[model samples]
Target chain A: MLARDDQPTPPLKRTPLHALHVARGGKMVPFAGYDMPVQFATGVLKEHLHTRAAAGLFDVSHMGQIVLRPKSGTLADAAGALERLVPQDILALAPHRQRYAQFTNDQGGILDDLMVSNFADHLFLVVNAACKAEDEAHLRAALSDTCEIEVLADRALLALQGPQAEAVLSRFCAEAASLRFMDSKPLPVMGLDCFVSRSGYTGEDGFEISVPASAAEQLATALLDQAEVLPIGLGARDSLRLEAGLCLYGHDIDTSTTPVEASLAWSIQKSRRHGGARPGGFAGAEVILDQLDHGAPRSRVGLKPEGRAPVREGAQLYAEADAADPIGQVSSGGFGPSVGGPVAMGYLPAAIAARGGVVFAEVRGQRLPMKIGSPTFVSPSYQR
Target chain B: MTTLFTPDHEWIRVEGDIATIGVTDYAQSQLGDVVFVELPKIGRQLKKAEAAAVVESVKAASDVYAPITGEVLEVNETLQTDPAQVNTDAGGAAWFFKLKIADKAELEGLMDEAAYAAHTA
Candidate 1:
């Protein structure tokens, strides 16, 4: 007997609110092994604008959520185990405060950037939906012998982002109003148990709530019922994050890019730089340390393409004179409705990045002039 | 005043020897957003089903093929600044280009509105 190849098997995973999404006419696409919405019936632009004016609900349950329970000893001792591998001031983290950092290879390149929030109970880890599998494998293989890592499989994550995000969220959790940026606390959302974090990918005031998988749909429905909330899909998410000057994992930053060269030096702590707790002994530490001493080649910068012609991903960036020779390429580029023009971000030589002004991007044999500048095209409205 | 529809959802509005071409409402809705559309240069010759234009959205890129052989007369300049017109009114306002029809016999191969709607459905 042989397996029938006539019908395509359904995708590997499903979100808690999968049925609700199907009911609302979501164009379900297989993304990162989960059946997720690429766009809703209203379309991308409308979804993007809705997130700006009111609260937008995002089903980010596909992202890997983990709980790290430290062995009883000291906070610094437990944080030191992780600090040896990734660069960040995790030990100094106050209970319930969150920190965004990356797991670095020895060469100082980021393996994966993730949100590590220290609650009174455990270290809550939120990793990229695409890189979740690799991240879990690496952590288990790397730290299994030393620390205990528990994969939070039964947990689901949701991001409520926009100007009116706090207003809607405050209705459920009154304690949420005083929570500063990068803060996480276990709060009751509409009588349901969850952890509400005052942070999100979009450059807006928002909360990321992690609830039990069984209760995910009820919570999503409760939030969606408010006139301020609408279901946002991956299309609006990509544009929103891009406009915020935030880096997307696979496209913008990869294992080849060091934190220093990628303009991510802000994530590297001063203590780590001067060898405070545990001298750097991870892979490629020497190269990373050396680069810290001097400067690294190729800095990440934003490009503003003149006119409406979008400079898409993988389009070559070059000096205007010698258009054939490439300087770098666009990692992510698209129309930014808030900026009222096309926006892009990519890597370029440090010299060009330092004296930022204008450069030409080669797209299908035409030289499209682009202005090199800061990543944040629109001012971030995060609740800090 | 003669307009014909292709099975692929392209519309050709024939006026004398020249015919204005664009995608139908069904095609635009299926394609989602219209971010980029590449049009052929004037005086360029094209064959039926040959690459006529390219429309790109956030997720996918599609080629707008010629329904019949013709010479490029004029391309839609409005799409350069406002390609979203295709999403708004794919048939009425977002016409891609006008092509000088090479053979009148090819018009018989196209489907009328009733036939096109049935074919698409």
Candidate 2:
């Protein structure tokens, strides 16, 4: 089998957990400018299944973590500053709570999607690794006068996700057990001060811990030492998130797509929309609110293939079996280990993107029948 | 019977006029997990180096090329249900298809086990 698209990448950067990954027989590949493991000896299928059945430890240090602190020393200052960049209710966010938000451009196009956490002193943000540099530059240029955009270059991030995650994590850090979904706190882990958040990209229940770069290996080892926790790689991470109906940075949501088109309008809280007390202060607020009221032309939807064949990314979507007209294209797709079939997500015309609708995908010159289903193929197991 | 390997990592075992073709262990390992295999139809004629089948893994899809000129005689239908068979026993039960050898002269262009091992190494 000849696999294509192995482009010559530039020199890749290694994470703090690089040595441990190599020692554990990880098959490292270049991703987001980092030398990261795509899978280990167990392979992608088993790893994806293992994460759903038990707990899986993922080294996501390649993601960008930044701390936003207002120079005035008031927490509201940082929140107010960030509110200008995203369309989320940042100022109204309760302390120690986290909310998902996206960095949108003036045209209502998504620059990047991120998680914002309200801390006791400042706002903490975690962004996609590929867009971190551009995100950093945007934050500095926009919010520099209000808050200090400090990139946590000395930090490493790890995600332990699954049903058994809480049981395995609460043993090491007592403060972690009390955290509900979207809750975060700084806890002592393996002699290091790490910020632990009860959230993850996977639809499963999990925690994302931010530890110092120097102590990342020790912390990962401690978590993996638990019987329920296994080291997962980027491959399983993608499949899991895809099955969960989560969007990847470059693939699903990008600068060309607005929040409404990407089916992320639910993320925009009612408190920030039109008719709310505080309205239209952030970038793209006007266009986004208009789309929210009028509706988007196209929307993202999940696809279940009628046959075993997977309708991969870039596959054209047709409204009918024999019609040559293309309606959409598959964005993210693969064999979902949990779904037990070929599952895919893509943007379809808003009229036909609803559940139970049929859309044919052109694969290998054949129009394969598919069913438009719920945006999420697998029910999220988040511990709310 | 004798087995030969191709630079593309396919293996074929020839016995009389029929030759069974499948991917090598190294190819399977490199491909990681096999989720779907689109086998060639029986009675289809194919030239050497032409695309014969497609293998879909969790990450991407790959094309399995024909190693020799032949007429497809049979296919491993088991792969449609259990593609993981290719990962477990690729050279044996997971053989993708059987071909009626149309040109034995093409065998001289392929590599033997030692040459394949050195080439892969």
Candidate 3:
């Protein structure tokens, strides 16, 4: 159970931009052991729409940042070592390119999803904040023999995302505009050295800059000083990523979900697929590959509620006419300001995962009608 | 007519036996970006401190509690088309419903304007 306001609160960690958030009218909340801003004065609705229209500056420093290097100081084959833990083709990942991957357990269930960027010499990794400790331990157990899992505690991460993102970031680093989607480059941003990646959680053309913790505030202030940029909080970040059809670590995916069932087969490259050259060497590859060949029992699908009431997380889903046995449940649901409707994502039986299929979400003892659709409520505008 | 508030942040403006109920401005500000509201049905009995209504914001869903025992008389229909009314004018036109106050003694127990202001403070 979470501690109440008057309760002797556990010490919450603060990010480098914590003070900046408070100065900008951020509503601070305890999130994943960090005192993070859930929203600012603009609120979630406006902040989300603003990010889609212009650019939004997000302080994502709560996410764990780590670098994997050979203990001998020479660049080890970090990708090869990492491939044993995840079912992605890390070895094929070109230098300066980033790939989305997941750490699967023996049963093919996801432990955590992460971003792996090949930095030419070492691998730069980003994992979810809540899962960082376990992820770090897992990495150490899996790859510590070959590479040192160095947690970069001194760096802060910032994401500048939207259509106008390039225009805003170009003021500091002109070379950032040249990077393609999922490309990374080490450059000087506003006099601060940073490793900037042309990617973000929001499915928009943007950049994620990793800066030294001491210089993070200056970089954030400079970016927010731009006309097109506004400081977005975690609330808008959740809604934006939800509308983009991305899975939140603990909510949409967890230890019980596999890549195939989570609708992330695209992340498993062809080289790792069954009958391919590499076939499968990663954890839970047998179950994952089998699910890939023969479909999984359930599939993740998007739901558009019939009425205005949002079908929130944990709301059970049943067939429109039947209420005895629920067919699925809403893993994530909220108002999609851009779509101008209530959008939700959830897992459903493969037979009923048909597009435009009708279902009912049992919310507060009421059966609310909903229609199943593709996971993406809004089409992604990535620069790729 | 006098305005009374519940500890849970709902406000009731009472005129004789009829009372208008809505979440306070502080509550709206805390909720942020009201998107959808599920109003109580007319004639539905609401016990004090019960979940009388559901307000869905951009972030999550919140329950608006009843300050006194009453039967729902009228619901603000404007919220069906535009729920942001709560965020725009929370204590005024965005009132959720009208209730026939069940007991005058229950109203006496609620916090007055000065008490509410300090309670929220």
Candidate 4:
């Protein structure tokens, strides 16, 4: 809960496309210390459905972009150094490939989830906006001797997502259609040098473009001009990712939840596990490896509310309707426009985490029924 | 018959000690899309300013308070299944409930159409 203080709050930072958002009838709100559009004139429901059927352009400039180059002049050294912090097998990451990773604390709890792309000579990373400053400091403190960290503060990130994404982006950058899922490289887009990655959070075939801040508006305007593209806001982005079963940094995975417990063990490569080439070297390896070998006490699972009422985040979960103690709590819950009903994700005791198992969520002093199911509510569409 | 509005954006149509209540068009617009609504039970007594109903949007939930003391005579059950009506026809067919006025004098505090427009402005 946020503190209700009388002190004046700091002024919110604006993205390069702030003016364009305001001009497009975006409803601005404060998010991650930035003034961002929560929804546009099209509203959340339409914007969400539009992204699934067509293409939606989003401005994600608030996220941090960093370039990590090895001081020893070898990408392998940088990858090896990074492997010490994350559980993923970064040493085997091929060129122009991107992998999802998380920064785990000493206790195995997740600090933040990020995407690491192997560029030609350096590693390009995109971290959450809320954790960027701390992530930068953590990197400098841990691997400064092995790598040179360069924070790209003058760049803007844009996501062109959905089924028609490749079609729309190909009009400007013909190379966009050729890149498969998780492929990343430097491509010339509309006369501007950009780092294009064929990956997105919407579970759709899309591309995330990292462009210069000075040319962000021009690129965004050109994309929006396409008949298949519409300007989406943070509201639809959240719903899209939620339905796609993607975890939100602070909400789904936090300082108290480990990757294994969060159902993210798939991201931890076999080489990082016990008896592999490199095993038990990363932070909290003992705890994580134990869970991998055996099982976690509790696990994250998707929830489908039996009724129309949404069981929002922080709602308690119960094993029985009249149970005095809650078995778990919802981390992220909302109306899934694509699902045509309310959907949620939360942790449940492993004993009761079976698929199709019944649980109860207390909403407004009443226990509502929910069904446990796979985390992926919507099937992902990747070029691969 | 007389129509009055509350500062909280509720509208009350009074006729012979009976009041039909719902949210204003301005309120519906501000709420964006209505996904769910919970109405009061019939025959329940409500005091002035008490929470009588709940309207939930895709993002948040809001309370619709009783404008004046009354007893719930009837509720619009259609809202339970078709909540989007609150967004499309909020001031007309989307009336939430009907009340039997307990004190006609309580209606004096509500604003007329012109006064309510100025308040919203």
Candidate 5:
């Protein structure tokens, strides 16, 4: 049945820990079709700073989880089949290791960015919440013949991140402290079976635990009981990721922006590029490889606004204050609590995308000056 | 001295012809944390309901409208450096600006403390 204009809007979905969030004074707001907490009673500023200093618990259960198992009983078969959709060296991924990848369209644009972890005999993928349905359809349509795509709907993802992450997590899962950055494995966390990954969107050292939906509240409650851990909401999550230079699926990297232009060429390994083994088989390989070799026409760069006023997303960028034509636009911008200033990311013509270059951003009918710099506003604290 | 509030969540403390303006405590709680504040220039003429100042939180920026027609007489310069004060003391020390009321008749349109409380409730 077709939806009518007079039909009432569908109600938002709630996570397993929704009740606990409300009990802790979380301010609930609609986000990605889920009724999620934007911040707790302590507020976003304190939550953001707390995550940087101590540990913070984040409910990322809204993201999609999928498993790709090879029908031929070989991990390479599934990795090879999956290579057709992404631009990463999936076959080279070691067992219990995770890597960042992006699903590219035929036009060299990003469909979605995801995390691919190599399990014992299968690949576990974590895709964005907004693009999960389309991603599942794309995977089934293309790789169903060689692999089995299982969508795990009965799971919840929680991120415990910060300097005290290892100290706090080790209390329940002692093996957690042993896994270095990018390591993934099935571990018993708080006596529950879970897929644990030593990776997160925030620059701080952390672990993302994938637990069963039924036991999510139990696990979250036990973790929050720690003195170092506090319930951080979506507001701090956005600012933390932004300060860490991680791209939000729809905002920083979208269908209109390629990985090369988005300054994510580092994620594209040499094995997937020209003259390497198994090169140019994925979608948009020709255009992506061309951008890789000759460089893209425009490049994404970090912006530091000179004033206290934040230069937010969609703010037009200009090279001159009086310029009639705009140069580019900010894709993601906001106040960074750790940096104690405003940080932004936007694309600029490659000719003028040099570090330390000055650009003007139009905010509230006023042209504010900003300096171009490295996108990683804060240094990463990953344990190798 | 008379205190009044507008539907937009701004509170004005009137003493003689000078009126001090700031956002209510409820507004500060909803806005979360105040990271920055942009005030109007002194001597600028503002019409009632006109966008006069800007209050920025970490997530978004909100416009503080003029509660009544007046000329900007002074602004809270302290907010430029320490905007967090708006969160700590929104009703008292975090006054946004002082306006020389151009027309005392505009005060009649504002709600008293009791009406504003009921309106917010």
Candidate 6:
């Protein structure tokens, strides 16, 4: 749920360059808690294709950024407390590294998926824009009395993504490209101080820069001047991430899905497994450990719909001949600009998923042939 | 040829008993980039303002309503391969189908250009 909004939305969020977007005639819509552009005057296909070729700038400022501090010094203290709830091994992370993980419930279902960065001074975290409040409340409830969580409201996040992304961003933070995938550093981009993380949702190479909200527009405009940059909207952002095989919280990975069933076992620390030093004590650890030992009943899989027709989210999937007995349903689906066809990711029987065969997605009334493929429809181009 | 529009944003061109049906530019724009179009089979019977076809955009899935009751005599097969025709030339080549008017009186209920402008407003 969003904070109370008593007034009508202003078409779209103004960003710092609401003027530029309006000048360019962007198509805006309400997303998360902000009015964001779904496409520019050109359209979605063009914006998507542009990101594949040049670079696309995304305003992800609505995403929440939080700083965690241990009352004392060691991050291990914080990680130990966090491990009781989240699936990632925070303590195992070396300094300046980040990991993609989720907060799981007692039933092993994911409450939210987020990025956690182990900083030299603080444990930095970023969560989805829509669930910021709920995530914070959950974190506070789980935090030990000694740990303190602070919201970074003054910061704004931007993602510059594509093949030429590094070349353009290099001009701002030359050393940024040198940082390996999932590594972050405090860097100055166009004289704007920010945390430059070698990360992005798009499978393409990119960076998510967190800067003071005050300097966001200046930095965005500066990047757009590079000729290769175009202001991307939430529409392309969504399609790009879907093509990358990344899960969108609420849509793909929700409170009903667990790290194990979502095929995110890698995020679980080895220590939490039955063989590790800590057998199973985390919340829902019993169920998670049982799934680990005996395998989950269902697992997330990538579904490639035949032809250009998309089998979108919530569309039912059934056995090839039998229409009534549904085996699974689509969680996320769309037209992948790179693949030049329709693609979807959904959950199905783990046994069916293990073999990697064909299935049928019931789009409308016709059954479309679907091949089970790897999650990333295109090869991920992260600058590792 | 009078351009008549249904409340659902479908527009029909009437010339005698044959009425041509297609979604309006406004409706297409709201649906975002057109990706797929589910064209109804020929000879399908349609009621006045009934769903005659499906227009699937990248952002959403919507049904094209019949502006005037009739029997669907022909559907635009071109939409199967190039749905963007609707976004690019909605009133021209993107016409969804042609219907044999069951009763000409149904066309009177649809809005004219001036009335459509007000209805959309």
Q: Model 1: runs farther than 4 Å from truth?
A: A1-10, A275-282, B58-60
The CA lDDT at A288 in model 3 is 95
**Prediction 6 global C-alpha lDDT:** 0.83
The 10-residue segment of model 6 chain A with minimum total lDDT is A1-10
* Cα lDDT tens digits for candidate 3, A97-199: 9999999999999999999998888899999999999999999999998897899999999999999999899899989888999998678898788999999
Expressed as tens digits, the lDDT of each residue in B1-121 for candidate 6 is 7888877788889888898889888888777788888877898998876776888776667878777778888888999999889999988899999999999977777788899889778
Candidate 2 CAPRI level: medium
Tens-digit lDDT string for candidate 6 (A1-384): 001348875554445545556666777667876766778865777788899888999888888998888878778887777777775677787888988878788888888888988887668899988888988998888884758999898888999999888899999887877888889777888878899888899888888999998888888889989989998988888888888898999888887888888888877878778888766667788788899889999888899987778889998877674567889889999887778778899999888888887888887787888898777898888777
TM-scores for all candidates: the values are 0.93, 0.98, 0.97, 0.97, 0.98, 0.93
lDDT of 2 by residue, B1-21 (tens): 888999999999999989899
Instruction: DockQ winner between 1 and 5, please give it.
Output: 5
| Per-residue lDDT of model 5, residues B67-116, tens digit only | 99999999999999999999999999999999999999999999999998
* Per-chain TM-score (chain B), model 4: 0.98
Model 2 over residues A92-146: C-alpha lDDT tens digits? Answer: 9998999999999999999999999988899999999999999999999999999
Model 2's lDDT to the true fold? 0.91
Angstrom error of the Cα, residue A32, model 2: value is 0.5
| Interface Cα root-mean-square deviation for all models | 10.1, 1.2, 4.6, 5.6, 10.1, 7.4
Stretches > 4 Å off in candidate 5: A1-9
Give the alpha carbon lDDT tens digit for every residue of A152-240 in model 5: 99999999999999999999998999999999999999889899999999899999999999999999999999999999999999999
Clashing pairs in 5: none
RMSD per model, one decimal: 3.6, 1.3, 2.0, 2.1, 3.2, 3.3
- Show model 3 residue runs off by greater than 4 Å: A1-7, A71-76
lDDT of 4 at A286: 89
Q: What is the lDDT of residue A279 in candidate 6?
A: 63
Q: lDDT tens digits, residues A1-384, model 1? A: 001237686656998878888888888878878889988997887788789888899999999898776666445555666776687777777899998888888767888899988876567789998888888888888766556788888888999999998999888889888888889988888878899999998888899999999999889989999999999998889888999999999888989998777778787767677555644555557767777778888888999997667788898899774666889889899877677668899999999999998888886667889999988887889878
Better of 4 and 5 by TM-score: 5
Instruction: Considering the true interface contacts (CA pairs under 8 Å between chains A and B), give the fraction that model 1 also has.
Output: 0.19
Off by over 4 Å in 4: A1-8
Please name the candidate that would achieve the greatest lDDT relative to the true structure. 5
lDDT winner between candidates 3 and 6: 3
